[model samples]
Every structure is written in structure tokens, then in C-alpha cells.
Target chain A: MQLPVLNNTPSQAEHGAKGGCSASSCGTTDNQMDSLPDSIREKVQNHPCYSEDAHHYFARMHVAVAPACNIQCHYCNRKYDCANESRPGVVSELLTPDQAVKKTMAVAATIPQMTVLGIAGPGDPLANPERTFETFRRLSEEAPDIKLCVSTNGLALPDAVEELSKHNIDHVTITINTVDPEIGAKIYPWIFWNNKRIKGIKGAKILIEQQQKGLEMLIAKGILVKVNSVMIPGVNDQHLAEVSRVVKSKGAFLHNVMPLIAEAEHGTFYGVMGQRGPTPDELQDLQDSCSGDMNMMRHCRQCRADAVGLLGEDRGDEFTLDKIEEMDIDYQAAMEKRKVIHQAIQEEMDSKRLEKAVKAQQHQQEPKLTTRPVLMAVATSGQGVINVHFGHAKEFLIYEASPEGVRFISHRKADQYCGGDSTCGDGESVLQLTIRALAGCEAVLCSKVGYEPWEMLEAAGIAPNGEHAMEPIEDAVMAVYKEMAAAGKLDEKNEAVRANA
Target chain B: MAVSIIDLCVNCFACEPVCPSHAISEAKPHFMVDPKKCTECEGDFPVFQCASICPIEGAILDSFGVAINPPGSLTGIPPEKMAEAMAELQSH
Candidate 1:
């Protein structure tokens, strides 16, 4: 799943200039590639949907193993084979978890580019908890290298995310069309929850709350979350931008605005009742408008539950249930091997956590600096610390600090760095607005900052502290002051801030 | 199973009450027929009960991919007969 080198793309420089990406070569051989944290790189390296570069090279497959759904939506018709139609929840056959594992192994062996296995069903994966978890539990051990992905409607996600994390399911996609229950009612007809059926706006409201809660929980646990929004015309078409805003604020890695497929043939209520699918131009316009300060995935094929091979191409017919069942496979031996693999993965994760803990302890023991602290800014959603990414930051909370203490100064509104209209401006222009918002700050601390903004800030003599840690604002300010004091650069930073002010 | 709704279901719910096996139930996108509970309306009706009442043409297919309620199933007129009738009507 090796991606082509950045030098190969004619628009590589333009992409780097966009301000979100770092200007390093996209080649795996480069030193800059090595500098990326293993957690981040490994998550993106082989995952086709997550990594734009890898989507061309690597491939992913979805197993239609979950056959039960708790909610009813106007757009879905699970009875139809989702594979042939270009929408979610269409599978020719629904396999048991065991059968699913065998199919996955067979596909992996045949297709070298198949690096990801997703469980996006003809039904919500979370609704069929036992089957979905069983498939993940076996795959986590059997195909550890094949990144496990799941797409849910988020109705059952709040209860399922913790167990999903235990199975080491790193990537999760939640299809959230709208945040407004009034609008959601038009999309989702009813939901079965807590042994009762709730209908209309009430059910939609409950679903919205649960989805938001599940999103925040997943983000807090550091799971790579992607939101899939089906652009339902005359229902939530005008509302997806708000969906984009909310999900991006909650730290969704990508928002995929898919078009509604309301063909009359698919016994779906929407199709039967004459709900029209968005035109190509209408879909594009909605996506453009919803692009608010977040990355929007435009290449989604709206794949079926049993879709295989690359995003655009369908290779599902070759790996049918009948075909996989005929193969000479050693089921008993595979199970035995899975146990050993599970043990090894557990040991590796344990060692990594231990190493991280030791490094943090040592970092805390470093000496403090005596340099006077000038104004510093932090991007945070909560009032406490710098945990949000710079691109997602709507405002920056300013803080003033000295060797003695750190104090909250004021908050400044910052322009949305991503999303909204594409023609409003480019990333470089937005970076300038951000810099202007942080006027006299010596440095701005954030959980992450893109390459363009990093370079722009450096040129402006405003240090960009892009540390991927959720540290308290006071502690972060003090640590920076101590580091600057140790390097004999504290006075220099303070002078720059004063001169700029 | 009596009749299975493929992806072509329009979810009109016209066939739900007609199934005597009680296999058909409300489901996402359309309805589902539980294979274990289905008897294909053996004792309940002469024709496949669910398909007999289904409104959408070719919406219900049997295990052999033959539509239980194929096109013209509702009108009770074969395509050939319909063509002949149209020819007769034009002459009149």
C-alpha cells in the first residue's frame, strides 16, 4: 500500500500551500516520513479511506455480516443486495462472523492491496452487537495488519464504542445526516431502543443526542472518526453544513457528503414516495457549502455492505459466499493461530504504553526556567487547556504568564480555518487572520497545526507550538517558559512579543 | 421462505397482512420475510399470498429468482394476450 511520491503529483506544491499538509515528500523513504509518530502514520499509511494518498494504491473490503437493524431510515432497503446498487446496506448474502472471517482471509490472500476490512452493513453494525463484535474480535487476532473499520448509525454507538476500542478497532465511521431532530425526523422514520419503539421527531432527537455523545466519547479515546452524511434532498440538504460544523468541532477526521439514491425500484419509503436524489451539481454545491474548516471526502462511492476491491471498482462477484465456501481452508488451524496472534498484540500494546508513561515521567522532572512569560494563546474547546487542532479552532484563549504564575488574559475570535465556502478564501489567507487574532502572543500552543500555518507563523516571528498533548494551559505555559529559559531564548521571545505588540 | 423482497422493494406494506406464516415484519428500507417462519403460504392461499397482494411489479422474487408476483401478475393478463387485446381494440 505504498503511496506515490509527492514529486509525482503536479499539484503537490499547491496541496502543501493549502496550509493543512506539511511540505515533506510523500515518499515512504524520506526522513520526514520517519519523523511522524507511529500511531498517526500507521493509522493513515495503509487505510484507503483515511489517507487520500493511499486510496489510489490500497484497497478495502466490507463484510455484510450484520443482518439486524434497530432503526428504520427512509433511504435504506436492506432486502436488496447492497453490492450491486451504489449505496450502503446492500449485500447479496449475509454471512455469520465465522464465515465472514474466512471470506476476509480469502480476499486478503487474493488481493494484495486489501489492507482494510470494514463492517458497514445492509444494517447498522452496532445494532447487531454480538455478530459485529465477534467478527472484530476474530479479525483483531487473525488479521491484525488489516485495519478494522466499522460504520454505524450512532444509535448503538454510545454503548458499543468502549467494547469496540477493546477489540482495537481504530477507525470508525458514523453516518450522521443532521443534528436537528426536526430535520432528522424526515430522514429517519423510527428507532427501536431500550426494548421500545420511538417514532418521528422524538426518536430523531434521541438519536441525535446519542450520536453526539458517542462522537465525543470516541474522540476522547483518540479513535480516528469519520462522519458519513447522506445528502437527502428537501430533508437535510440545506442542513449538512451544520452537520459538518458539529462533527468537525467534535474532531471528526473526515466528513463524506454522499448523495441520496432514491430509485423507485428499491422498496425504500423515500423511493416509493418520490423523494428525489440530489443532482450531481446540487450534491457538489452542498459539499462546497458544508466544507467549513474541515476536510471533506469527495471520492466516496457510497459502497454496498459487501463491497470489495477499490473505492470505484466492484470486485464482489469474484468473492461470493459460494466461492469462498468452496475453497480448501483450514478453519481449525486458523483459530489456533489467532490465539497466539492475540497474545502477541496484547504484549506489544502493553510495552508501548509502559514506554510512553516512562517518557512522560522524565519530561515532568525537567528543570524550570525564570524567564518572564509574555502573552501566549491556546486552542481549546473546553476552558481548561490546549487540546484542539488549529484548523478547527474557532477562537483562541489568551494567557499571560511569568516565572511566578500564569493568568488567563482574554479570548479572541478566530476565523474558521476550514469548511464553509471554498471561494471565501484559501488556507494561507486564513492563516493570516489567525495570526492577526493572536496579535501579541509570543507563541500559540495547539494539539496540532498544519504545515502551511506552521511556516506562516514562523515567518511572522510568532512561534507555533504544535505539541500533540492535552496539557493544562497553565502547565503548558510554564513548561514553555522553562524550556525557553533553559535554551537562553526566553528573553528573545518576550522581546519579539513586546515589539510586535 | 414464501417470498423475499430484494433491493427492489418500495415498502408499500401491501403484503404484510396477507402472509399467514407471520414471517413478514417491518424492516429498514422495506420489510423482511423470516426464512425459518415462512411456509410460502402453503395452507393459507392458492397463490403465494404475499406476492398476490404486492402492488409493485417484480418486487417479490422466489428462491429460484422467478418473481412470485411477476409483471402482469396483478392485472391477470399475459403480455401476449394484452398485445392481442390492444390489436383488437385498435381494429374496433
Candidate 2:
């Protein structure tokens, strides 16, 4: 199946020539967003983690106030002094409710784009009810404009839904790995419930029932729910599509299938036992399979519990407890500035949409180009841009370009050739493997390509181009296809020669 | 009989919170279960809480020094099959 076309705009090929949708333009005009009620749309429009479009413009922060979890996940290794770690369940420092509020105010004052405050936790937010609720209570009273979010394991979620709604918590994330108790048994060892520890499939059954019940109850209160499932290679990878389907049927607004991080250094059970995380290709395939059932959030960064700033960045150190204590923040003045800034951003986005509409109209009036479809690969680190370096790319998003427009085919996993150093010891064989991974692609587009890989790609009959660096992947792939067509490379005989080469 | 967490524990902190007896504490290498306070969930839980939540195979032992959650009990993937899967992944 083709990647979901997010926008309501006509296909680029329908515009005849020199017309393709950019990531920002397409994401902003999401058909799904248009279908939602105005209230629901307003809630998600600016949440960086909720709307794939808004992440480019907005920022979110997670306060590590909750440090206790009720359920045991094999992938979790919650410890302290994890300042450099980027995974969930890791935090630099734990904060009290008052300190968390102070830090939030300080961050909001300094960063006007910071509009959402989430309590994702170094542990389950609902598990630490008092600490989590106290932080939310203070934030809701002081900073009423900022969105409040809570993410839970869903074990304690059913019991805490009432308190969540009381605090105006509209966005809730539940990490539901599976609906089947047997598969859940592999991921969660036990859950403490009703003053007792339930183990194996029994505990899983209780957790799943509570999660489904919590999802229904939250939706009844008109709260938006996003289901996050960890894609464990053998454990729950194959089971996640069903989970997505089940959650979507239960009124979940979005599904974020995050890859499990099982690196041995994290000291998790799966890591020590040599359990492998799903490859990028495997993850993309699962997301694609489930996209038909629900709106698949393809831009999740699997943020840390104490994550700060934008989705891909962290600025937690900027607003530490000590730093917050020293600085006096005038929240009233900050709120005024934020309102003006948010209005300006909305105006800019409006103009961008208008510009894209005009371009589409112009292209539609032009004569169509007769070109054959060619598959091209793009190196991107999300945001739908051709931004990743050739050596650093873990996956290449394959796209098909023809007179029909550019369409995302699938993702191809590549063994990274560069290890972030100047060493090139075994780069040759790795590069060969990468090229083999992109067998049918006519060209590979990236931000930058090394001289050796460029030469090798050319020898392999796959043109390598970095000219469209930072451009939208769809636009870049279409431009490359146009270039190939101009060079008569799309001719039947030329195609045969390249294939045989 | 009280349960014990061996050196094989990876410091995952899974067992510390679920202990009904409040017997588990963080130590240098890994978590340790106190014999004095440990009840093994005799009247509280059907299964030992520490052994039930410990992710590593054979990380927690019973009073007789036998693994509560032995290899292949949690994941259900046999040791040989797990090794094969890892080798295949590494080869890729």
C-alpha cells in the first residue's frame, strides 16, 4: 500500500510538471485534521508530539516528577544519573511538584514555542498519583494556556482517569504493547494490582483489560488517546497491528509504534538476554500495515521522560531546578509574548499553504510530461526531508516517481558505513551491503555523499545526488526523476543497460 | 523462604517496586533481597514478587537455590533458538 497522502491537494503529477508537495505543506493540510471537530483539531494542532505537522514549529517538555511504576517491562531500566541517555525511563534528576512547576514556568518563559507540558515519567505517571497530580494541579492553575499531557503504562490508568480529567488533561498516551495476554506475557513480567503482584499471563490479562477499559473511559470523557506500542522484534512486532486495530476501534486518535531500544548498555532484561530490536525496515513495514486501520504517527522520537525543547532536541539543562530557583520569571509577560509569537507562526503557515495552492494551480495548466516511473531512495532522519548523510542513514525511504506523482513505496534498511569517526576500515563491504539493500533504486538522494561512495554508486549505475539537501523527500525524488528523464535515462534501452550494469 | 537476587541481575529496578514485603534494596552490583523482611509473598501473593518481575533468566532464586523464572520461562524462546536468532541478526 502507498503511504497515506496527508493533504487534500491533488497529486503532483496531476499538476503536469514542476509540482510536488513539500512535507510542511502536505502535513499542514492534513485531510485527517480537516475531518476532526474544531475542538479536537485545536487540541492537536499545536502539540508537537500529537500533530506530525506541528512538531516542525512547536516544542514540548516532559517533567520527571513521577519516579515509580506499577508494572515491569522487559525493555525498561529505570535508574538515575542518565543525563546523556535519550531513552524513556531515564532522567537526570527527580523533582518535587513545586520544583517541577517552577521549572515548567522557567522553560515556558525562556522558550515561547514551548506550548505543551507532559508528565511522561522516569516511571508511570499514574503510578505516582500524588506527585503527578500535584504537578498537574499547579501547572493547570498557573499556566492554564499550556496543554497538559500524561503518559501511562495503562496498568494504573483505569483507576486514575477520573483525576486526569479533573485536571483538564486532554491528551493521554497509553503504552499498550499487545491485546493478547500470551504475547503481553513476554513483554511484561508482572504488574502490582489490588495490593498484590500478578504474574505471567494472569497479570497481562489484568493489564490489557484495564488498558482497554481506561481507553474507553477516557474517550467517553472526550479526551484524545494516543496508543504507543514498543516494537519488540520477536515478542510483539507481529502483534502490534492487531493492537493498533483494537485501539483504533476503541476511539484512539493516533497510533505510535515505537521501536524498542535493547542495547546491552541499558541493562534491561531484553538487552542482557540478547533480544534484538526490530530493524528499520521491519518497523516501517509494521507501521505501514497498521496505517490502514488508524492514523499512524510516523514521526515519534521515543523521547525521554525528562525530554525538553523540540522533538529531536533536548534543552533540559537550561531549566534545571537550581537555575529555575535563581531566576524570577514574569509569566504574565511571557504569556503575552507567546500569544504574539504563536499568531505570527500561524500567519506564516497560512501563507505557505496559499503559495502551495497557487503552485498546484499553475502546474495543472501546464502540459504533462511523458515519463516512466522510476524508484529512488532518500536518506532522511524524519521531518520528511532528505537531510541525513549517506554514511549515517539507518534506513532509506524508497519512493516511486512517474507522471502519476511521487509515492512512498517502502523503507530499506542499510548498515551504516560511517561510525561517526574518520575511520574507514571496513567501509567498502558495508557500502556494498548498503548498495545491495537499495538494489532497484535508480538514484540515492542525501544531504551529503562521500567521494568514494559517489564513485562506487556511479559504477553501480545508481546516480548519487546531494544537490537537493534538506528539500522534502517527495520533491527531491521527483526532481531527480525529471533530471533522469531529461538525460534520456528513462528510455527502455537505457533502463535495460542500467539494470544489466 | 526468602528469595535471593544473584549477580546476574542487570539492575533493571523491576523487582524493587513490586516486593510486597519491602525486602529489596539497591546494592553495588544489583538489587539485594533482605532475608529478615522477605516473606516470599506467602500470604500476600501466589508467586514470589521479586522472581515474578525479574527479567533476567535465573536472576532470582528460591530458598533451595533453584531459579524461579528459569531460562525460556518468560520469553518462551529456547536458548538455542535465541542464540540462532541473535547470530542471524548479527550476520545481517
Please give, for every candidate in the order listed, the TM-score of chain B alone compared with the true chain B: 0.72, 0.85
For the predicted complex of model 2, DockQ is 0.15
Question: How good is model 1 by TM-score?
Answer: 0.53
Candidate 1: residue A302 Cα off by (Å): 0.8
List the candidates' TM-scores in order: 0.53, 0.73
Mind giving the per-residue lDDT tens digits that candidate 2 earns over A1-501? Answer: 111222222243235343453322221123235434477667777677766546767889999888777787888854334566677888887788999999999999898888999999887898788889999999999998799999999988888988899995889999999999999888887787776667789999999999999988888887888888999988888788778778877777777788888864565668767889876557767876665312326556677889989776789888888789999999999999999998887786556545545643454355656776677888876555789999888767676666545555545667632334432345457778788778767899999999999998988778999999988665677678778888988866346322521
- Best DockQ goes to which candidate? 2
DockQ of each: 0.04, 0.15
* TM-score of model 2 vs. true structure: 0.73
Off by over 4 Å in 1: A1-42, A292-296, A329-501, B1-92
Residue A295, model 2: Cα distance from true site in angstroms:
5.7
- Top candidate on TM-score is 2
Docking class of 1: incorrect
> How do the residues A242-312 of candidate 1 rate in per-residue lDDT, one tens digit apiece?
78777876777567788887755565667656679876447656765564212224435577788888765
Task: Give me the runs in candidate 2 sitting further than 4 Å from their true place.
Answer: A1-37, A79-81, A293-296, A357-466, A469-477, A485-501, B1-92
DockQ for candidate 1, C-alpha atoms:
0.04
